[model samples]
Target: MPIPSTLIGIPASPGRAGGRVVRVAEPPGEPATGPAPADPAGEAARIEPAVELVSTRLTARAATVSGDAREVLEATVTMVGDPALLQNAQELVTERGRPAARAVWEAANGFAATLSSMGGYMAERARDISDVRDRIVAELLGLPAPGVADLDAPAVLVATDLAPADTAGLKPGVALALVTEQGGPTSHTAILARSLGIPAVVGCAGASTLTDGSAVIVDGATGEVGEVATLDEAVEAAAAAAVVTDWDGVGRTADGHVVPLLANVGDGPGAAKGAADGAEGVGLFRTELAFLSAAEEPSESRQREAYVAVLSAFAGKPVTARTLDAGADKPLPFLSLDGEPNPALGVRGLRIARDGSGGDGAGVLDRQLAGLAAAAKETGAELKVMAPMVATAEEARWFVERCRTHGIGRAGVMIEVPAAVLTADEIMREVDFVSVGTNDLAQYLFAADRQSGPLAALNDPWQPALLRLIGMLGEASERTGCPVGVCGEAAADPALASVLVGLGVASLSTGPGARAAVGAAIGGLTLAQCRERAAVARAAADPIDARRAVAALDG
Candidate 1:
């Protein structure tokens, strides 16, 4: 037999493993034509039960996990139960005389298309809609729902890409690692894999062509996959990776330059995990947790309790909390825009309040800041608050004023918009600090959809243009004396972590599972070496050459 050529991909979660491949089967295709129901109402009624079953199943799955995984599953459950989806399905069944399964398929595709057209985070939601649509349609057809089949033994799970529910349900003991032909660093597959401490390589060129049960090696750090001589050898490699190592509660390069290693957390449990994993503090406390399940704005006290849970966990360590980042992909029932042609570019993040929509969305930010202030007082924690999607210096000043009104001493803005990077010096002068959200930044910079597999290269952190933007922010931070941090999927990559530090980022914030590896990667090198590599990476013409040039620097 011929040896399989090594496949290159993006390193999502850092670790190394090897195993026999267990390919996840594709979802059920378009359902066959079925006999029309006797009545349109009856056909439409069938949609509810199917949706309920899928929702119940998803809810159960969510119960077994917490933090980001739980949030992803719960969001999917909400998608399953969306009334708009029901109405769309009903209209198709009643007006078009379609069967329940076909109605659901058509309705879901239409909605997914709308989301895809919006790009950025919205495109990712489109994939989730398709996953839920498949499960619900399968229920109506009396067929088993699509997902990773239950693993009877330890193996590498290979797929085109995993859905949120599919990735959330994976167990580390049985699912050795994940390798997907499609998906980018900021994809749900990458985020969930890091949370689970599973090695993952996404966007592998030839991953889907490997046969089921073939022995292969998956190096998540290097994004390499190739055939191994035997399954025994693969098992040995995986077993070797199982040995545990602990992280000392300090983050610095070999030459003694301090780089704060913080954690991106969603809730109390996630905060605790991050702290336990030696996170200096919470770099990004995603405030969306309080909003995701709420039908309306949560009370100040309710929001305070949730904030207190995380702030108290970190204690004296600084916890940077971001206000509600809803709309676009994460539309809230109470705080959603009406019929925006492109919600991704519309009233999302800071604009949700600043856009002057009929609702007092600005009040939403005010109340949130008030709740965070209350929580900070109650917990006696070092609370640093920030707003997302601030593109201009004026917007940065507006957010800072809101933070000041709430008596929050520290305030910042997330550098997700390209304009934020371009005018970073001006914006930084208006705030205390800034953290770059490389995921959204990459999408907007390249004008490529973040969730599109084929466009993953453009969204990749290795892109010179993306690094140049971060460099611009770093330069601004230097001039303004405003600390810069990265709390994005890019920070989770061990190699990129080094480059980001070289680019003058003050802190690197990532998933708890990634801290040790990122710390170790930086621990071996002096800041000078990191800076040299960053310069080398920036000089490369493309993502591929950038990665290769950086790798060659070790020699």
Candidate 2:
């Protein structure tokens, strides 16, 4: 075969996967609503059992996957058993003498259409609802839900897109890669693929057209895909990443400007893994994993043990821990966080601490703080605590004081909210340090939903607008004499990491996978060269132009 044209897409996960394509089959649609069954009761019994089966399937999937994918699957499982949906469908069978299949189909379709019209995140769920309907209908018809699970061979999953539900049962190595015509960095597919360490390229426009069994080289880091025998070898050769040798202590530019490199970890084991990977310290040791998995409110002792384990993982190295950053995506079962029409913008982060209605949420906050203090006392770990979603200096001060009262000597606020970024200088006066969570900052600044595939480009770290904000935060840090850091997914991109360091970010923290890549990238450039790239990038018209400008500087 002639060389295949390369397809560019968003790099949702970093790695390489090479294989033939295995397109997940489309569901057999609304099976013949053929001739109504004489007994509606028998149809109801069959339909209900099918629905239960789908629910059971989803629950099993949820148990298998965690983090974002687990949340989406659990939500789907609930949708399958929705009493309102079941009642409406059963009424058609019992009262209107309609076939159970048609009744369930119409009910699901009606609800799906209503949800689709809502637009934004909810509109995206129409596909999810449709998937649920197909699964139920397929089970009732003695057929299986359309999927690639039965495929014995390992291959790259190529399709228009795999719904969260569709991809839930995907085990690592079952599909060596995942390429789709649509998805964003924050999509469930992207999150799940990354968690599973499956190299993935999402939002590949023509990916669905790739011939089945055609060997392909998928580069997840750069979102490049092609059908060439030597593409993998060529990609590795062309990487041109900075030379990396295992000789690291603290990270510094060639010009010898000290800019500490750190790791963004989610759990205790993650901290140890990051340390083993040569991370000097933890930049973002997320504490939400403990609460999210807890069946009830975790005791102070439990929280302390968890905190101590992570702090000790670094072997007494500095670890910055963010207190319970939960809300929409990370729900606390004990807290009554009401569902929001758009939870991303609504109550989350430090807002939950402020949401301390009746003190249930407040107690969780205090308990967490006390645990950090206990851990610090027990392990002698230099644990720095920070609060998420602090908007004003007052909120910053309030958070600092809360931590201080709990015996935390050092505290800070994440500079994610634009207001906080703009007021970083003042907020820093009330805290010990500042860290920017650029993912959310970019989303809120651009007013684009992070999960929207079309809006994915807007969330690019190279965007001149986002660079300007990082520059502002850097300025704020210097003006206030507070240590400022970038602890976001943006820090994981080596090229972008170089620009971020140039933009005045004092430290960089990234996922464990990128720690060495970023450290190596930073080591190759002189401080002045980074400044040059940053200057060229800041003058660009858009993200693409900014990327080009920076690349030209490297050239």
lDDT of each: 0.86, 0.77
Please list the residue runs of candidate 2 whose C-alpha ends up more than 4 Å from where it truly belongs after superposition: 1-6, 14-19, 27-41, 44-138, 141-155, 163-177, 192-199, 215-252, 255-259, 269-272, 275-278, 293-296, 327-333, 337-342, 355-360
Q: Deviation in angstroms for 141 in model 1?
A: 3.0
Cα lDDT tens digits, model 2, 1-555, are: 111448977777766666667787767676556577788888777777888988987898789765445667877887899888888888878777767777888889998877655444455567688778877877766775766566697777888878888676677777778898887766667766765667788888888778777777776666777875543443443333313445375688888998888877776766777777788888988888788757698899998888887888775677899988877545567887776666667677788878754247777889989988888888877889888878899999888888878888889889877888787788889899989988778888899777677888787666788899888887877788898898977787667788988888899987655666677778889998998888888889986577667767756
lDDT of 2: 0.77
Q: Candidate 1: RMSD over Cα atoms?
A: 2.8
Which residue pairs in candidate 1 collide?
Answer: none
lDDT of 1 by residue, 5-34 (tens): 379888788777888999997778897656
For every model in order, what is the number of clashing pairs? 0, 1
For every candidate, C-alpha RMSD to the true structure in Å: 2.8, 4.8
Error of 2 at 374 (Å): 1.7
